[model samples]
Target: MLTDVRKTDRLNLMDQRGLRTSTWNVLTPNAPASKNLLSEELRKNKVSITGLTETRLTGCGEERIGNSDSLLWSGGSTRRNGVDLALNSLARKALLLHEAVSDRLMKARFGHKHGKMTVIVCYAPTSNSGDVTKEDFYSALSRCLATVLPP
Candidate 1:
């Protein structure tokens, strides 16, 4: 298993123990089988939290996986760029707030021993994307970061 999983480029903070997080750009997990496989992987790896990109899940909602793990997802009308967060039992208890900022971005706040930490998961437009699209994503991300609570 990889050591650390924080999207540091988006936001950097001190690390905490026992919170094994990771990020994956899953093409899509709309199918039940795919979701099941994903869940199985989570357990097998013992991931405390995972950031999912390109989920393509319409709308925003939470899903309970088995009796402990949970999935928080966000997306748009069409089956396109989406992101989500999968929290195991340990991370679930630390979860305080979450939001579906847009199809390309999602945010979650966890209450850790050091107070709180905000995690932003995003799927940025590729270099081939239009300048406007790239600008929009960065702007939205900036706004999201601006709203973080003071330490």
Candidate 2:
């Protein structure tokens, strides 16, 4: 396993034990080529979980990428923005629940030996977008967080 999974400064506060998680902006995951590439990268890095943005896949559901990996994803009707969580076999086994909040946000919960961990993956609108759009996104995010009860 990789020792340092938090390549981004924002993720430095996360626990860094044996759990390996990554986040990537995957441009367009609706394409088969992109999905294959993502799966390859996850295997190469031995990542336990990977959060993806801009998947461009419609609707929300779970898909088995291969024998050892699974994907939970959510997208809007227009296929514009999306978020997903890819879990390796080990991580999949520990999964307790997963929610597809909206096109821009998704969440997954895992139960480990010690406790439960919740991962929220999201994508925000660019500054070029209207202020109303940004506000709506944040409002949806707040609702999603409010639904999560403490362990």
Candidate 3:
């Protein structure tokens, strides 16, 4: 018997050395109190980097959160389907490049000894979403993936 492995399957099992990464749907972390709480949770879990969805933070920008932790966020003009990438002090130092692709997609590049690693944070459309919305997300994701440097 033969098994077929997809790209996502490979990504799920890829080794990241000692890097600790995670994803979370935070509902709405628009308030300072909520952001502080989220920072605490990340610290308690020992997560070096995290991808946040539904942040509900309008516009694109970067901010300092809880000492040295950095928060880079991208959102639509109206604050819907936002995405963000948070990195601790250590991980922030290795960041090479990052871009706010859209409200639903964000891309970051990190430097390693061997090569660069691309981390794409995306909030994909749900099954109930319209076809056009889903298609746009995938299309944008494809373009982002195509631009990643070889590792």
Best by TM-score, which number?
3
Candidate 2 vs candidate 3, TM-score winner: 3
What is the lDDT of every predicted structure here?
Answer: 0.80, 0.79, 0.80
- Which 10 successive residues of model 3 have the least lDDT summed? 1-10
Worst window of 10 by summed lDDT in candidate 1: 1-10
Clash totals, every prediction: 0, 0, 0
Clashing pairs in 3: none
In the range 1-87, model 1's lDDT, one tens digit per residue, is: 011233323222334545577999999988777776887899888787899999999988888875578888889889999899988
In terms of lDDT, the poorest run of 10 residues in model 2 is 1-10
Report residue 147 deviation for candidate 2 (angstroms). Answer: 2.4
What does candidate 1 score in Cα RMSD to the true structure? 7.5
My TM-score estimates for the predictions, one after another, are: 0.85, 0.84, 0.86
Give me candidate 1's TM-score against the actual structure: 0.85
lDDT of 2 by residue, 2-27 (tens): 01122111222224547889999988
